[model samples]
Target: MTYRPATAAVPDLGVLTLGVEEEYLLLDPDTGENLAVADQVLTTLRGPAREQSRQEFRHSMVEMVTPVCADLTELRDNLVALRRSAAEAAAAAGARLVAIGATPIAEPHRSVPDKPRYHAMSRRYGPVAHDPAVCGCHVHVGLPDRELAVQVCNHLRVWLPVVQALTTNSPLHDGRDTGHASWRSMQLERWPSIGPTPHFESAADYDRTVDELIAAGIMLDAAMVYWYARPSAAYPTVEVRVGDVCPEVDDAVLVAALSRALVATLADDVRVGVLAPAIRDCLVSAAHWRAAHDGLDGELIDLRRGGTRPAWVLVNELFATVTPALARHGDLEYVRTQLDRLRDEGTGATRQRRILERTGDVHAVLDDLAARSRAG
Candidate 1:
């Protein structure tokens, strides 16, 4: 079934401002190998782009954050500019900025930056810290109160797998198809606290759980909670950290629009005292694994019902659920068109596999990713 936009009048546009944080890997343009020159690349950025960009835990990776955007159009423009500036900086530093979710070509040893926190993580986590050079897209929706953010997380839990399925960009790792759409998601499972956020009694309960994890040495700090959706430790937003960093600008914009609309809808539910669904955590985790394995190319667990359904069907349901919010934010038609485009071209994983199947070369996949990454 097709998604229909809501007929409600648009609401005030300032309710839930949104922003995006995307992490990327630098690669040798000719060899398609990971390059450990993030520092050099950062030096090449100027003005606002440089301010929004920072080095990630791994020396081979960099992250670009968009300023808080009031609407999807502003967010898209910021993302396009950020990607252009980042690609230019990487080129200046003798590398290509590719937005694939994980490093396709493996390196013998990946280096951590010289920061104390990064070094401590490397020393403590050992192979877990060193092995995977994965990246993800984090969407932050404005919510000032921690209690409301926690409630919103509960509302968001059921749809996390669907979100992951929509943005599965990391199919290949170490120059091989890992038999999974988002290998980056699998790689994160090794971490201590990384999955769907649990149902919380209140914001206090959430804080206590985080404190307990830290006290038990399961997490380094609040920032390391790493749940798929959580009250941001650094910001007043509910940060949804489920999706792989999308390959194309349109994909990222689609994710941002859906995420903001979802948050706005769920927050309204919270205001009206709608209870969160009581799905089993194990089931949610299983659904996540299924999404990581198949992306949108196969069926996904239908949480509302008892059986699995095609991934696109579930995505349609999500759009239906959040239609009013989409309409309020002036994103209904844009999201509709983008969803059609996504279905036509396929998810990033599908595109990557298609390139590999046709060309029989991993470098060709990287070449396409670099070109798309720079494209507006």
Candidate 2:
């Protein structure tokens, strides 16, 4: 069961085409419980136009696959259309499709999708794969060859935590405010292959390590190498698989644009042999921890500065780092406007906490997230 890209050859790798893939949980609108009805939602979405909405490993979750978009505007438009289709289907199934990274309600133990790989995961990993309803956003940036792509991932290791900081949408897990911005990432960390990957010297080194893992039965296949960023198994692009799934479509646009710009900047650096200084995994992990624990409102470990700074300051530095790349796509103003709005209004993570504070009801957070998602 090998999956390949829908279109193999990309035009002009210099332009950096991109595709955005997002996973989401379906919820009962009233109680905010994860409804095991993704199949029903996907069934309602059936037809030539609705192929982008598909099943995930969990029965309560669905994935949205966007077309290979050229730029941010097209990405936003396609995401809006896809979300509209998914919302209608979910509504028809007596559920609301949420773009949240993790469900707030205490998740009822539910069945995994009836797939051989999923069944095997449940059998082997038990609760981690079957416990909570979690979702993520994956952004694929065009990189023609595996070597450049692997290099891009290696160079990206240092800043991935900062990017993840801006999109921490899963603060509450299993009905408790977990005191962290993205508990979905914590659940993800349960997997052995999950989290940041070490630097690989070359594409062969990357593939060879994966081969060893598969041969040793540590991973089922090449697709199971769950690095924060890696060469896509099915696409001629490097996929960044971190970040909690965002509620608003525009937030998704912001993440995608920033991520693409970051990757592009790194790819350029790789070509010039001017890679950023590599921070060891310990510091990288600590920076990520601070990012998740405090999100934007609190301080974060500034790896470049070797000290802690407010996340907003760190995030601003991130934009500065990739300013040239964002400008290349004429997305500087758009990114600036969107990121400013995200900072002012706060991400879904901060907003989720505010909602809980205001209503004193965890369910209100879900309702707000669902309404915001469905509205877009």
Candidate 3:
């Protein structure tokens, strides 16, 4: 897609559109096991919804991307309609659509999709490719300038852990509690390119690093540069890949709203000649690990203070930082309410653990995820 750069003048927050891509697993409702029926499910979608959806690396997974949305309400409607359509399609194909981050129950094997790229990836990555299926929510905020997008990523680095903490839904994997809020995060870190993005000096520096990784055979191409945040290869936007796939539409929208606001606030900082903070890479990685391990229930590494603080304290700080942008984009009230709901109801990981604790059944957890996913 051809992208035109924004004018010299700093654009209003409203001009930065939002788009979300969510990956989901198809499961057998009765067995609570993954069902490799993505092709069958795809055939059931019609028209624009079909165009918006596609099969992922695994035959048991399907992904849906929303069209560019001017505001959160439009994004929510698009997501709801897409989820409803996909859930119905899965039902037609004799499977249930689930929005959890990773497969809760152990599966004997997950088949790669019937595509040349997927087959090549499976061959190259081996066990990493064949691991239990995992899903993530990728949020894209409009920024046509690649240089600014790279800078925005630098500004976004510190907030990655906070966002990940809010959307941890993969606490259980391999039929047991993995003892991590986002087991999917740990699973994805096996890839060499996955983790916190380095502080790039400029767009050239970012491109050079990507080229070097590809040349060294660490990644197949630019698309495999799976840092938590990066300049999106497919679109002219900064793609935030930190969060697991959220179970409910409200959770997804809350993440999307916060992501867009963060981008807008940081873009303004870039325009005003603000330099990105000089945070140590090692500390940032440590902070992310803590977010994955404890989610919102424990202390997170305090990047600014050189110590740990309650996760909710850092979350509130993030909100304070982005409040101006949120208000400018008319998302302040919605974000506030959603954050309240999150505090009261807990993260998806917490909810899943509660169900397992109360019922002592893994299948019950899967059932709840399936029902919420279809609730759209």
Candidate 4:
């Protein structure tokens, strides 16, 4: 899904500054059925007040955004408040909201809203827009410049799959276990523009390639190039849109912290003339497939050392690499603590399966997710 960031001006903060956007699936509190109540949710949030929340491609999906924040505590507070507000609104509207990768069992929502752009998208994309619900988390981290953003995107290739492995929460599709950690990752690949991007020599080269894609009709606009990592056209930050919408609020915070630290470390490496690792587009695809399939419970392609390794090993290696950057932002301890919690609870995909095992009902998955989402 494309993100149209708000046009309000935000003061330039340091590289450690961050913002996160999370999409949630609105559901019936009792039946676990997807409910099209985003309009009501937004209206409630806007009770004589302006809010950053907005609609998504599906009426059942709504995105809550946080402002530019400096640390994890501020980020946590903003996120918790947003989730609470949305949940209260959903309850008032006779619905509920949950943060998961995809709806295990949901009716297809084919009716498009009366918006002109959505109408055009439905016409251009056909039945693809009518598919069942999917939600994701996008983390935006401030960057020094567009050139550095391009370099960071290039540097981020091999690590993309590793990160995906960490956040694989969507395990069910169409009411059945898909046998994959993040089914949404695979589902998203059906789109031509939603994958790892090729290396660009510079910011100008990246812009030209975008122009060419639009010229060739492969993309509708800059907003349509939904690469896993890209320079946000609407902001000065680099937006990383690879992970599924995390099941827990702290999971979302962990992903945001790691993303910000990764960009800061990579950009500093570029500034110091350290050589950036080279990665091929095909290898990147292969790596992503591995992560989307196995998550941390299985092996992963070690993009840096060029071999296969357990996802746990790969994650520890990454933690070591980004430790200094995390220290720079005073995020090291929080990152580590949150990661431990994630591992102990199992990624969202594992939890979804566990819920199914316990309750012997598919609806239990959505029920549990909604409870956890609101509890935060």
Q: Which candidate order results from sorting by TM-score in descending order?
A: 3, 1, 2, 4
Off by over 4 Å in 1: 1-14
lDDT for residue 287 in candidate 3, whole number 0-100 = 92
| Candidate 4 Cα errors over 4 Å, as ranges | 1-15, 47-50
Worst lDDT run of 10 residues, candidate 1, spans 1-10
lDDT per residue, candidate 1, 1-376, as tens digits? 1122331333323558889999999998877888888999899899999999988988788999999999888998999999999999999989999998988987544778888888877777888988768999999998887777898899898888999999999999879899999999999998878888999978999999999998998888888889999999999899999999999998999998899899988877776667778889889889999999999999999876767899999999999999999998899999999999999999999999999999999999999999999798
Better of 1 and 2 by TM-score: 1
What's the lDDT of the predicted structure labeled candidate 2? Answer: 0.83
What is the C-alpha RMSD, rounded to one decimal, of candidate 4?
Answer: 5.4
What is the lDDT of every predicted structure here?
A: 0.89, 0.83, 0.90, 0.83
Could you give me the TM-score of model 2 versus the true structure? Answer: 0.94
Per-prediction TM-score:
0.95, 0.94, 0.96, 0.93
Encode model 2's per-residue lDDT on 22-102: one tens digit a residue: 888888878788888888888888663367776788788889899888988888888888888888888898888889888
Give every collision pair in model 4.
Answer: none
Best by lDDT: 3
Ten residues in sequence with the least summed lDDT for candidate 2? 1-10
lDDT of 3 by residue, 1-376 (tens): 1223443565554568999999999988887788888999998999888999978988888999999999999999999999999999999999899999998785555778779888888888988888888999999999988888998999898889999999999998877899999999999988788999899988999999899989998899998989999999999999999999999999999999999999998888887777777899999999999999999999898777778899999999999999999999899999999999999989999999999999999889988888898685
Candidate 3 accuracy as lDDT: 0.90
